[model samples]
Target: MMPRLDSNTDPFRRPNTNHINSIYKQNLSKFQNFSEELTKRYDELTPTKKILVWILAVFNVIAVVLILIFHSYIIKSLVKLSDKWADLKFGHLLLFTLVFMVGFPPLLGFSPLSLLCGMVYGFPYGWPLLASAMFTGSFASFLVFRYLLHKQAVRLIQANEKFRAFSDILKEDQSLLILILIRLCPLPYSLSNGALAAIPELSAWTYALASLITSPKLLIHVYVGWKLKSLGDETKTFATKVVDFVSILITGAASALTTWLIYSRMQRKLEIYHSSRQQTNGDYDAMIFGNFDDNDLSSNNNVELDSNDFDADNFVIGDEDDDEEEVELDEVRAETDQADVTKSTSPTNSP
Candidate 1:
């Protein structure tokens, strides 16, 4: 047997203990490991990129300090900027609408960008600004996979039994609910966009509409940002400030409770969904997703399919007349899986 490595060991091995201090320690350990992983990746960047990264870091620190020192001035400037934006509001909002569609922005991730929007436009503007963007962006991905890159995407999906089985749950009733739950989950946006897009059973408009269920999360984040923006207002009386503080407290508590409830509900629904899926498909095929944990849904990780798992059961290799197409698709799946396997598995992955 191969020797077990400490680096491969999981921190979650301990028995459940709901103490607050234990929770803090667990999170601290995770954060430390996450930072170390980020540092290692940063080291692998090119020298030119490293210089640009340092410059960006320094600028961010300076910007934060300036914002802290001149918050009142900054608020006044922002208010004036908001007034100026009114004349060309759609043009400004339209530009930001493209942000989520663009994916993991180099410097600014979606969270901060969404918060910035909330800070600028407030809560009422939240869904109105992002609703069309989210739907359109997701639909565009679907279109690419279904039409533009259909051959490439379909070959990948058909390459693995797991991928096909994952798609097969569409046969079950309330499949749309599962689709909605998926969009509601905090999975990587673009990957989910492409994954759902690649599935033939899911219609373009159906998939796009399911995305709207996630709008509440956008609202919660933007509402918090709106509150943050309000805190900077110099005109508020002490009583009003107190009121705002209390409102923030209420919002935070409600959001936390609501998120927890939704998460729990989604998990239970997924368990049932998987159960029904397993029963419908053969036991061998269905168990592929059986091992998947719902809590892992919170992470930004994506699984790449391995073509070695491909077989006649899931795929339709083209006829004699379409010999060129069969060979091309087989080549495509093999090449794609080779790249995926290389990226996912290193020397340490070997047993």
Candidate 2:
């Protein structure tokens, strides 16, 4: 026979099911309304954003045109200033040095100006003067860059994945070798200096060490410039071109070789570090798992008995009492074991 159900007797209830359905419908309607409102707001913003973009584009075009119009006048004014400052021989060298430090990376050229410094100062005086100027300017620029432009430089470096990886490699050793290599080789002097300054791994002392080691290259350039000053006009022109070309080619080759060597060395070091780390991890696991076979726990049990504190005679029990106690304990243990075995072997009876 089918069971007759009573509302009072039934544990499961469905009261307010219609109310819950109504609430759910209301919530869904509210959500749809809110979503539509958001869509309307976004649609309103689209046209405003388009207008702003067009305004920015128009302003950029005007700025570029203005810069083009003033470009020739700016160049002429700079030339006039250069002529006025030319009479101050050392001053000219210093000015060029400042310009080289500030503009070299952006302009990507400085040799012509440095040669002009040599032409002004003449051989013996020029080489020393140019070298001094370059070193001072470079040193000051490095300090300023380390303090002020470091964040920007870091951003630039992080933009390139290869450079970012190279930075991580620099963190391992923090040695001056990489900095000196970049400086001694022809790897864009100002750019390399600024980039190196941004690296936290390169300490001030390390930077100074690299600068001292790499100063010789600047001296070489100064020497070439000084020698060029003595040659005839035509010879000087030809020599300048030859020297510039040779310097670029030689520096490029050296930079490529150095970069390769640095990368290879860094790779080898990283491999060694990873191997050591893995070995350390393995050792840690062995210790944690109680697999350290060399540990001898059993040997500790052989510690010599302290006769002064404990006497065998004092602890001794007569044979009769010992035998009686042993028999009684054995009986108790036997009874407990029998009870456990009986419980395990017995089948369950329903209550």
Candidate 3:
């Protein structure tokens, strides 16, 4: 082995540097593109969601800062408040439900309430307690929108083409699928509830059932708030802190990934559904952007073209009268030539 140390023939020869670099570049490019797409989609969030994000961010920062500055006083006050509210558990729940019901609209989202529940009751108790409030709040909102705000919701839906298109999808028998997809979408929960209210066909029970089905997603936000409470605990061991940190990280990552996936899937479904709607109506642009009435559609359909006015059959390639004149002139010239030939032959004989 020592005598036959041929570098070229060695099995442990280094791989091609160019090939490895090419593979690395390809993977890097793919990852960059994937990240760019996610960024683009995130930037396209609805105005409601953007507002919610801003509010949550500013509130969290201000709260954290104030809590740090007045830590002892704040804790003492909260402990006193907790003691007073401890025996009034049902009252606390009822108050939360009332607040949620009042605020669970496009103007005010339910996310903050969900987090409050988690921070107050902890996850094991908080999840179910919040779920109940959410259910009640959802049902209340549905009733309010369906009855009290019916006209306004209708006006809202009619004014927005996207909402109308989504409403059309909900009008179908497969509306459950559409509603679920919309719920799973990273859109504002209030918007979904309001839009569902605008649809007369979507029964109150149907909306309630759908909310129950999709309520599990609230747990993700609750978990975040619950873990955040752990951060303030001074008695936690190093191992506990590490576990909580990891748990928070994993939970956040999973929630984000799940939201992105749902958004992507919902986007594809919307595109397909919108395209089908456009095809059905045969108006791609107007169907998407224009609020067309049945009268307008019917008027457009009733437009008629008269074939006689076009007269396509009477179109001649060339001038027929000019051709006839040319043929007559040619015949007259031939006859004149014959007459001239006869006259010339007769004159020559006489001479």
Candidate 4:
């Protein structure tokens, strides 16, 4: 049975009518404004950008599905295959490494391959193997793109404002730190390689060093794969199982957090670069004078402007007074011309 509330000591007091109405109206207005803004932003995306966003979303969805649902089966199959071809494992690894080095399709991610290395060999072996493969692949792609498709890649990169801004950062002799930051970003390995290839000023040593610096990120993926191999053990203790699950979750979370932080830092740097460039290039005097040399201006018919001609009230853009000022200027000019004509037409008294 529910307790009844006393008239004088009611806990569930009714809200004020005016307050409730105001709150409801405020919330409704906020929702409508948010919906309108979201729709506007959606409409602003270019078709190509929209396609790329959709592709990235699909890729993320697929990755999440693979990790959550099919991981056990996938791990079992890969392990069985690795055991069956234990003798040929190293050779297959070499072949995959070579293919990665070629980087034919830049969208092909490297994480899956790194995980495979861990599944075949333990994390200790996997980390070194994946690191070597990444460094070799990066260097090879760098050389290939540098020699073969340099012009094409540069043109493509220059078309994107963000990439152009990043490239400008690379040109500042801070390539090593910038490249390391880029490597730490959540971008796919092949994509990063392609962008790095477009930087004409980036040295081979700096690229290799940056690759080495970010190689540790592969450890988390390799560890996840290694733990996955033990997940299917039927004889494992309950505590052991719990520990393994927790470790995997922690490692994955840490990797994601670190990657997000690095990516955010890169984005912030790019934003700062863009803002500084705008401030530098946005000066009214500089913009007006940039295309015209003083000599060129002297060669043309020059019109001098008086300070009094630029009244503050007359310069108010889009105001009624602006139009009135224009009419007044025309009348004044006509009066001056008429007075000059009359003076010239009148006979001189001295003559």
Candidate 5:
């Protein structure tokens, strides 16, 4: 009104600032209510879940402490169990075999324990027992791993690129050979078996074959332990030292050989891959040159045609006959005369 302003142009004609402020305040209140609801939901954990979490945390702590404090006790207990099992005669041998077969895998790494079994039980008893136990344990572990922890095991195997490659090798026909070599060598058996369980390509027969071949060392250990019971203390100690030394040497040599073979195979594969890459590059180069030549020729032809500026119809039109109509009329007249002569001469056409 002060300056005769139009009603639509007046700033004060718009909605009041207070109304917008009220709406924002309402929205903020709603958001706060929603956030409070979410917080309440988060606080409402189940009692069982809470208890389980606490229990697992406590057990993990205790396990760590026991491992640190009683490491020697754990080792001695395992050795004692092995000795006690070996002392049992035939009927008890079967029971001991079952127990040891189930128990020894986690305690002794595969090859050393297999050798221990052989040493304690002798060749005949140790061989069959260790082999059977190993095969059974491997099969059980495989089933457990494949069914229960397959995804986790596979992730671990794939995390290491080399292990993934080796896993692929194990899936092939030479799987048994690779397994035996790995077992005979210084590679970790329990870990390998666990990883092997995750591979879909590994078969029971391949696992069994590898176990049978690699188990002789374990049987030797059981045999040694059994024989040690009858020998004098000094002789037993000496024999133990000798067996340990021999095992170390054999394992070291086998490991070295396996490493060399793996390296050689990798080298050969790399060479083949390099050759293939070079051939591919050569073909690519040839294609590029051929394309370049064709393009050049096409460009030259296009340039020549563009320079002439010639119309395609001009040359063909110059050769056309102007008497084409007269020629067609004469040909039609001759054809009519011939048709009339033929009609008079022929019998069937005259009627």
Candidate 6:
């Protein structure tokens, strides 16, 4: 039963604030749902697996300490293998190391290898060697996938719902933009390689163009290594060492921030695409992004303006029109939408 308003109630108070509260609740509910989705897998872990995770985490901490102490020595030993191809009379070539980072299983990976380039070879020499290898390796992989493995890759993508959804988004005009964003993200090299490879229509030129945009990212690793090398000089004063340490920290923070922003923007795009798909009834939106609730495709997505009886003089300064309700944007062209204008103007008409 609806409660009747008191006749002597303060008119300045919002007479019907339920709509705003409901909107706030819907958003809060979505956030909770998202949080639950993220933690579901962790919550489901068995006792044995949880113990294993802790053991591995402890070992990882120990490994990090050991690596930090002997990192420079280890990096140098790895870089200077003394293989004839790697060791010329002039200087050691890091091409093979970078190539291995790009190829199957992807050992050591791009991050450590590029850092090794900067630390061992140092900049001016390190930047170009690593940059050229990244470009050429990515180009070669794109060709290999697009021609040699196209059929198998297509079959694999078709067999997976998630990959199929990813492929669909790639076909859009924003495909190149998406690729550039993915490159900027701090994901595994092989992961990005497989994703780009799956899209049969994605050209080598387009892939190269996206890769070029991320050229600055490789420089970040080299820059960090360069800074680290500066800190190792025994002759440097305390103040100089402090400055170098701070700069390395700042550079690392900046790189992390850039990757986070890029990843967040990509996520927002996916959410928007998910919302639009829900509106248009795209059944497959759930595969890539998680499946949403009725809140997603709410029938209440159109504007609804209603008044039991609005009083202008009763409105006080700093207080909104105590009774109005506004909903989501439902684009209505006046010329074409004139027919539906009388459909519903009451807030109660929607969910």
Q: Which candidate has the top score in lDDT?
A: 4
Lowest-sum lDDT 10-residue window in model 6: 323-332
The whole-model lDDT of each prediction reads 0.67, 0.62, 0.72, 0.73, 0.62, 0.67
lDDT of 3 by residue, 82-200 (tens): 44544575856664765467434666647766665666667767778777777777778778888998877787677665577678777764466667766776666666567668888
What is the C-alpha lDDT profile of model 1 across 1-351, one tens digit per residue? 998879537776775467778878966986898799889979999999999999999999999999889977876776555445545748555546655555421223566556556766778686567555656666777788787777666665565443454465554543667677656654556655655557767888777667766666677767776776676677888788678768888987987777556655665665677887668686665455434557656677874555556655676433585898888999999999999999878666456
Q: How would you order the candidates by TM-score, starting with the best?
A: 4, 6, 3, 1, 2, 5
**How do the residues 1-351 of candidate 4 rate in per-residue lDDT, one tens digit apiece?**
998877757667776789889979976986898799877877899999888988999999999988789877866787786555445846566636653664533547566666666676767677776777777777777777778878766765765555676788788646577888877876556655766678878887788888888888878877887877666556788788789889999988988898878876887787787787778787755644444557868886664545554557554335589889999999999999999999999998883
The candidate maximizing TM-score is 4
> TM-scores of all models?
0.49, 0.42, 0.57, 0.62, 0.42, 0.60
- Greater lDDT among 5 and 6 belongs to 6
Clashes of 2: 0
Candidate 4 stretches with Cα past 4 Å from truth are 1-71, 92-99, 102-104, 155-162, 284-351
**1-351: candidate 5 lDDT, tens digit per residue:** 476767767776867789899979976986898799866755686888677877998999999999779855764565566667667666345643553454322344554555456445555666666666676776677677777888766875876555565675555435465666555544455565667777787776677677766655554456544443333223346668567556656755765676667655554554565577689898888754433456767675642223244455544323237578778889999999999998899877364
Clashing pairs in 4: none
Question: Model 6: residues >4 Å from true position, as ranges?
Answer: 1-38, 43-52, 67-92, 100-108, 150-166, 282-351
Model 6 Cα shift for residue 101 (angstroms): 4.3
- Of models 2 and 4, which has the larger lDDT? 4
| TM-score for candidate 1 | 0.49
Show model 2 residue runs off by greater than 4 Å: 1-100, 103-107, 122-125, 226-351
In order of listing, the candidates' clash counts read 0, 0, 0, 0, 30, 0
In order, what is each prediction's RMSD in angstroms?
Answer: 22.4, 26.9, 14.8, 13.4, 24.3, 21.8
**Candidate 6, pairs of clashing residues:** none
